[model samples]
Target chain A: MPSLDKTVAEPMIVFDGVEKRFGDNVVLSELSFTVAPGEHVCLIGPSGSGKTTILRLLMTLEKCDGGTISVAGQSLSHMTHNGRRVPADEKHVRDVRKRIGMVFQQFNLFPNMTVRGNLIEAPTRVLGMSKDEANARATELLDLVGLGDRIDSHPTQLSGGQQQRVAIARALAMRPDVLLLDEVTSALDPELVAGVLKLLRDIGSSTDITFLCVTHEMGFARDFSDRVMMFDGGRVIEDAAPEKLFTAPEHERTQAFLHAVVDR
Target chain B: MDNLGTFLSVLSQGLPFTIIATVGGILLTIVLSFVAGLALLSSSKTVRVISRIYVEGLRGTSEVVQLFWIFFALPVLVGFQIVPIWAGILVLGLNHGAYGAEIVRGAVQSVPRAQVEGAIALNLTPGQRMRRVVLPQAVVEMMPPFNNLFIQLLKSTSLLSFVSINEITRQAQQVLVPRFNPQAFEIFLLLLVMYLILSLVITAIMRTLERVAAARVGRRPSARSRRQATGAGVA
Candidate 1:
C-alpha cells in the first residue's frame, strides 16, 4: 500500500463557508471542510443532512448558493478574470471538474453501453486518450473490480453489486485525483453491500486517490475511513478519527445519531 | 373477377406516388423532429422559442389546411408554384415532424437524471454527454413512440389526394367512381385491404427495430423464453 502521508502542503479539496439551498429548504449552510490528498474521509448522517450534497457540489453536479469551493488549489466556484475573481464560466468548471469523479447511489451505469464502453467513455472523450490506451485501462480497471468477464456485457445485465463495481471502475478510469462516492452501496441488497465495500477498501488501500464518501453503513465507515465526520442540520457536528468518532462521539448530537444508527 | 383485376392495376399505378410521398415525407419528418427536439433543449432562448413556434404552429392547425395553404395559397403569395406531389410531401413532413418533436423531447427528458449526473461527473462536455450517454438511452425510449408516429404519418399520406396527388385513395375515386359505378363497394374494399397491408408491414418493421434497440440495452428476452411466453406454434 502507498504511504498516505506524502500529500502536498495544500489540501486536495476545500469547501469554505459553502451554502446550498433548494427553494426554501437549506441543504448545506456555511459548511466547510478540508480533505488532504490520499485521505479516506467518510461522511455519516441521517437522510437529508446534506452529506450527499457535499459530494454533488464537489463533482460540480450542483452549484453552491454562497461561498467558494477549491480543488487542488484552484478555484472551482470562481475563476480569475482580469486579476479579479468572478463566477466560474462553463469552460472553467469543466476544466476544474476533470480532476473529480463520482459514483452514485443508483450505480447509474449507462445501460446502453457495454461495461468496457462505460469505463472507456470519459477517458477517451474527456481525457482524449487513444482508443487502445483507453481499452487497456478499462480492462485493467474491470479486472481490479472483479468484472473482467463482464466487460462486453451491458450494465442492465449485471447485478446491482456488479453494476456498482462497474460504476466505480468507470469513475476510476478518468484517473481523477478526488473520487466522490455518494451513498454508493446504499441501494444495493444487504448481501451485496459487503463485496462493494471490500472493493472500495482495496482501492483505498492500493491507490493514492482521495475518497470522500457518504454512506450509511457504519461498519464500512469504521473499517474504511481514516476520519468520519458526523453531520446534522447541514453542519459537521463532530469530526474525528474513525475509532474516536464511532466509539466515543464527543458531542451529544453525534452520540444520539450514532445511537440511532447502531440501534437500527 | 375481371373488374377486380382492373381495379388492382389502377391502384398499383398510383402506388409509386404513395410510396414516394410516404418515404420522402417520413425522411423529412425524422430530420425536422431531431432538429426541433434538440432545439427545445438549447441554452439560447431564441432557439427554444423558435422550436416552440414550429411545433405549436404545425400542431395547432389542420393538416388539410396546411397542405392546401402550401399547395394552393403559398404559390399565389410567393409567386412560385410547387408541384403537388412535392407540396404534399412537404406538408406531411412538417405536420408529423411537429408531433414527433414532442416524442423526442419527452424521451430525452425521461432518461434518468442520475445518468446525466454520472456523465457530468466525468467532466464530459455537454455535447459529448448528450451524444455518448443521454441519447443512446433516450433513443430506445423514442423508438416505441416513433413507431406510433410513423403509422400516423402513413395514414396521413392518404389525405394528399385532396391536393390532386393521385395516391391510392384518389386512384380508387377516379377509376371506380366513374367507370364501374356499381362495383364501387368492391373497389373501396380493395383499397381498405391495401392500406391494411401497408400498416401491417410498417408494424413488423417497427417491431424489429424495437427489438434491436432493446437488445442493445440488454433488455432483450431470450428467444426461447419469448417463444415460451408467447406460446409460439400453438395454433
Candidate 2:
C-alpha cells in the first residue's frame, strides 16, 4: 500500500467539490476527494450513498452536475489542453477514457466473445496494438488471473467467479493509468466471492495502476487499501487510514455502518 | 377451355410479382427494423423521439391503410407519383419496419445494461460496443420474434391486391371471379401449401441461425445427447 509520502509524489485523480443529482434527490453533494498515483482508495457506504456514482463519473458514464474532475492531471468532466477548457469532444473523451478501466459489479463479459477475445478487444481497438500483440497480452492476463485454460471459453461457459476474474483481466489488458472497481464481487455467490477478491488482491499488489474501489468487502478493503472513505448521503463522513477508520472511527455513522457490515 | 388457358397465363405472369413483393418487402422490413430499433436508442433526443413516434404510428395502424396512404395518398401529398409496385413494396417495408423497430429495440435493450457497461469499461466506442457486444446478443434474442414477424409480413403481402398489384391472391381472385370455377378452392389450397412450405423453409433457416449464434455464445443446442460439434464449421 502507498504511504502519504508516496502519495504526495503526484496526484493521479482530483475531484473538487463535485456535485451530482437525480431530479430533487442529490446523489453526490460537494464531494471532494483525490487519489494519488499507485494508491488504492476504497469507498464504502450504503446502497445509494453514491460510491458507484463517483466511479461512474470518472468513467464518463455519468456527468457531474457540478464541479470539475481531473484524471492524470487533465480534466475528466471536460476537455483541457494546457489549462484551457474546451468543449469535450469524442476524440478527447476517448483519449481520457483510454487511460481508465473499470470493472462493474455485474461482470459484463462480452457474451459474443471468448474470454481471450474479451481481454484482447480493447487492446486491439483502443490501444491500436497489433492482433498478435493483443493476443499475447490476453494470454498473459488470463494466466495472471489463473484462467489460462479458460481463455478460449465463452463467458457463459465460465462460473460467475471465473467471469469476474476475466472482466478484471480484460480491464487490466488496457494498462489503464487508473482502475475503478464498482462492487466487483457483489453479484457473486457467497462461496465464490473469495476467489474474485483474491484475484483483485493479486492485481492490487502486482500493478501500480491507481485503484478506486467501491465495495462492501471490508476485510479486503482494510487489508488492501491505502485509504478508505466512508460516505453517507453522498458526502464523505470519514476519510482516514483503513486501520484508523475500522478500529477507531470518529463518526457515529461510520462506526455503526462498519459494525453492521463487519460484525455480521 | 379458353378461360382456363388465359387464367393459367395470367397467374403465371403475376406469380413473379407476388414472390418479388413479399421477398423484397420482408428483406426491407428486416433492415428497417434493425435500423429504426437502433435509432430509438440514439443519444440525441431528436432521433430517439422521432424514431419512437414513427414506430408507434406505424405499428398502430392497419397495414392496408398504410399501404394505401404511402402508395396512393403520398403522391398527392408529395406532389410526385411513385409506381404502384414500388409504393406497395415501400409501404409494406415501412409498416413492417415500424413493428420491427420495437422488436429490435426490445431485444437490444433486453441485453443487460451490465454487458453494455462492460463494453464501456473496455474503452470501446459506442459503435464498436454495439457491433461487437450488444447487437450480437440482441440479434440472438431477436431471432424467434423476428422470424415470426417475417412470416407475418409474407402473408400480409396478399393485401397488395387492393392497389392493383397482381400477387398470388390477386391472381387467384382474377382467375376465379370471372369463371366462377369450383377449382378456386383447389387453387387456393395450392397457394396455402406454397405459403406453408415457404414458412417452413424460413423456420428451418432461423433454427439453423439460432443454433449457430447460440453455439457462438457457448450454448448446447439441446440437452439430448447428440454428438457435440467442434467450432462453427462453415454455416
Candidate 3:
C-alpha cells in the first residue's frame, strides 16, 4: 500500500523484448508488453503459446535470456551498478521480487502448514511481522476470502476450490503490489471452477492491485480484464480492450483462435 | 538350577558391551546420515563428490572387512589405536550411515516441486524453504528406512566379538560347559529371542517417531493412537 515508487505514472510491469528458451526450443521471442498501474491484464491463447512462460518470468521462477523486465519501475533482470547496467544479483532479484506474488495452476499449498499457518508464514518470516500481528492479519485475509471458519484446517482437508481460495489468500498476505496468476483454476474440478473465478472477479473489482493473468477461461478474460492480449507461438498478435478484442478482433489469427476457443 | 544360573551369569557379563555398541552405533549413524545426506544435495560439486565417496566407499565394502581394517589396520596407518569397542562403534556408524544417507536423499527429492515453488513464490529465503517446508515432510519419509538401518546396526554389534570384545556372540562361542556337555543350541536359541526383543523395541520406537512426524504435517491420528495417548495421559 505504500507508494511503490517515486513516480506514480510508470507502468506496474514492463517487458521489453524479453526472450526465453530451453535448449533449442524457444518459449518467448522478443515479447514486449506493459500493464498500467492498477490495470488488470489477461493473456489468452492456445496451450504452449508461451503465455504461462510470461507469468513465470515475471515471477522470477525463470530468467529471460534477453532484454529486461521491470516491476513498479525497478528492473528485475538487470540493475545499474556504478552507472553501468549489469545483470541483477541474487539480492537485487529478491529485493525486486518482494513486490511480486504468484499463484500457480496447481494450488501449491504447503501441506506442512494449516490454512492459517500458510497465510502467516510469509508475513511473519519475510516481513518480520510479530506472531500476534500476523495471526490478526491472517484472520482478516481469511474473512476476506470467505474461509474464516476453516482457518485451522489443513489444505488436504479442503476441496480444490477451497484450497485454491486459500492459495489466493496466502499470496495476498504478502501485500504484493503485482499478482501474477497462472491458470489458477485449471486444476480444479469442472464444477469448482466457477466458484474460484467468481472469487477472483470480486478481488479484481475491489482492489487496485496490478494483475497479470494467463488463463484459458475466455469468459473471465472478457468479463474481468481491462485488456486482453492474444498470443500465438510466443508472440502477441493482438492487444486490445476486452470488449473490442473478444467481440471484434482485427487479426486473422486472433479471429480464428477465438472461433476455435469459443466453439469448444 | 545351578547350570541355569551359570549360563545366565556368563551371558549377562557381555550384555553391557553389546548394548553399548548398538546404542553408540545408532547415535553415530544418525549424525553422519544427516551430514552426508545434506552434503549430497549441496550446491557445490566438491561437496556432492565428497559425500558420494563416503557413501559409496562404505557401501561397496563388506562390513566385517571394514570393521577389521578400522580396528586393526587403521591404527597402524594413523599411528594410534582406539579401544576395539570404540572401533566397532565407528565402523557400524560409517557402514549403515551410507544407506541412511541414500534414504535421506530420496526423501528430500520426493518433496513435490510444487511445494518448493510455493515457498519461493512466498519469497522465503532458501534456508527457510528447506527448514520450514521441505525437511519437516522429508523427516517423516525417513522414519521407515532409518528403522531398518537401526536393526541392522544392532545385529552388526555381534561382529565386535571378533576384536576380543566380550559380547553375547563371543560368550556363546567361548562357552564349553564340558561337565554338562555342549549347550550351544540353547545359547543360540536364547540369543535369537534376545535379538528379536531388541528389534521389536526399535520398531516400536520408530513407529512412534513416524506417527509424531506425520502429525506435524497434519495427518489425522487414528482412533487407536488417540486412545493410547489418552490412556498414557491417565497412567
Candidate 4:
C-alpha cells in the first residue's frame, strides 16, 4: 500500500467549489474535496445525492456548471486562454481526460470487439502503442483480472461477473492515474457480485493508482476504501476513515443513512 | 415484341446506360447518405440546418421533375449542361440519398447510449467514436433498409428512359413495341424477369454484407438471441 501522507505532495485530484445541475434540478452545489495520490476514496450516500455525477464530471463526460476541477494541478473545468478563464475546449478536456478512466454500472464493453480487442483498441488508436506491445498489455492485464482464458470471447457471451471483470481490465489497460467506478457491481447477479468486488479489492490493494469510487456496495466500500465520504444533497455530510465512519459516524444523518443501508 | 429481340436490343443499346447509371447512382447515394446523416447529428446548428435543407428539399420534390430541371433548366440557369446520364444519376442519387440519410440516422441512434459513454471514457475523439465504435455497431441495422433502397433505386433507373438515355423502358416503348406490335406482352415479361434477377442479386449482396457486419459485432440474425443479449445486457 502507498503511504497516505497529506502533506509534502500536491493532491492527485482537487474539486474546488464545483457546481453541477441539470435544468432546474441541482445535483451538486459548491462541492469541494481533494483526493491524495494512491488513496482509494469511496463516495456513499442516498441514490440521488449526486454521487455518480461527481465521477461523470471528473471523467469530463459532463462539464461542471461552475467552479473548477483539477487533476494533478491541471485545470479540467477551465483552461487558461490568453489570460482568460475559458471553458476547456475539446482538445484541453481530452488531454486531461487521458489520465482518467471510468467503468460504468452497465459494464459497457464494446460488443463489436473481443476481450483482447476491447483492451488494446484505445491503447493502439489513442495512445499509439505498438500492436505487439498492446497485445502483451492485454495479456498481462487479462491474466491479472483472471480472464486470460477468455481473451477472445465477446462480452455478450460472458456472465455479468466476467464482463465487469473485463471492464475493470479495460480501464486499467489505459494505465490511468485515477479510476472511477460508478456502481461497478450494481448490475451484477447476486452470486456474481462478490467475485467482482473481490477482484476490485485485490486491484485496489496492489496498485498505486488514485481511486474515486461511487458505490452502494457499502460492505465493499468499508473493506476497500481508506476513506469514505457520506454525501447528502451534493455536500460531504461526513468524511472519515472507514472504521470510524461505519462504526461511529458522528452526524445524525450519517448514522441514519448507515442504519437504513445496513437494515436493507 | 419478340422476347429475344427485346432482350438483345436493351442489352446492346440501353443495358450499358442502365448499368452505368445504377452503379454511379449507388456510389453517389452511399456518399450522400453518410454525409447528410452525420451532418444531421452534428452539434453545430448551421450544419444541421444545411443538411436538413438538402434532405428535405430533395425528398419533398419529384425525382422526374428534378431530373428535368437539372437536365433542361439547370444549364440555362447556371450556364452549364449536364449529360443525360449524369443528370439522371444526380437526381436519382440526391432523391434516394435523402431517404437513406434517415436510415443511417436511425441506425446510428439505435446504438445504446452507454456504449458511447464507454467510448468517451476511453478518451476517443468524436470522429473516432463514430468510425471505430458507433458505425461498426450501427452498420448491422443499416444493411436491411439499405437493401430496400438500393433495389428501389435500381427500379427507379427505369426513369432514365424519360430523359433521352436509352435505358430498358425507352427501348421497350419506342423500338421494341413498335417493331413487334402485337407481341409486346412477351417483352414486358422478359423485362420483369430481368428486374427480378437484379433485385435478387442485390438481396444476395446485402445478405452477405449483413452477415459479415453482424459477425463483427457478435450479433446473431435470430431475434430471440438479440432479445436475450439485450435483456441481460443493460437491465
Using lDDT as the measure, which candidate wins?
A: 4
A1-264 per-residue lDDT for model 4 (tens digits): 124453328889999999999999999999999999889999999999999999999987788889888987779967889989888798988888998999999999999999989999999988999999999999999999898999999988899999999999999989999999999998989999988999989989888999999999999999999999999998999999999999999999999999999999
lDDT of 4: 0.87
Better of 2 and 4 by TM-score: 4
In candidate 1, what are the lDDT values of residues B1-235, reduced to their tens digit?
Answer: 5688899999998899888888898899999999999899899999999999999999999888998889878999999999888888899899989988888898889999988898898888999989888887787777656766777777888998777888998999976779988888899999989977877677677667768877887776345433332211100
Worst 10 residues of 4 chain A by lDDT: A1-10
TM-score of chain B of 4: 0.91
In model 3, the runs with Cα more than 4 Å from the true position are A1-6, B1-5, B176-181, B220-235
Model 2: per-residue lDDT, tens digit, A1-264?
346575457688999999999999999999988888889999998889999999999988888899988877667766766778777888877888888999988887887888888888889987899999999998988888899999888899888889888888888899998999999888999999998888888878988889999999999999989999999999999999999999999999998998899778
Model 3 agreement with the true structure over B6-107: per-residue lDDT tens digits: 667777888899899999999999999988998999999999999999999999998999988998799899999998888989999999888788878988
In candidate 1, residue B1 scores what lDDT?
A: 56
User: Model 3 scores what on Cα lDDT?
Assistant: 0.87
Worst 10 residues of 1 chain B by lDDT: B226-235
The RMSD (Cα, Å) of candidate 3 is 5.0
TM-score of each: 0.94, 0.87, 0.92, 0.92
DockQ of each: 0.74, 0.63, 0.63, 0.73
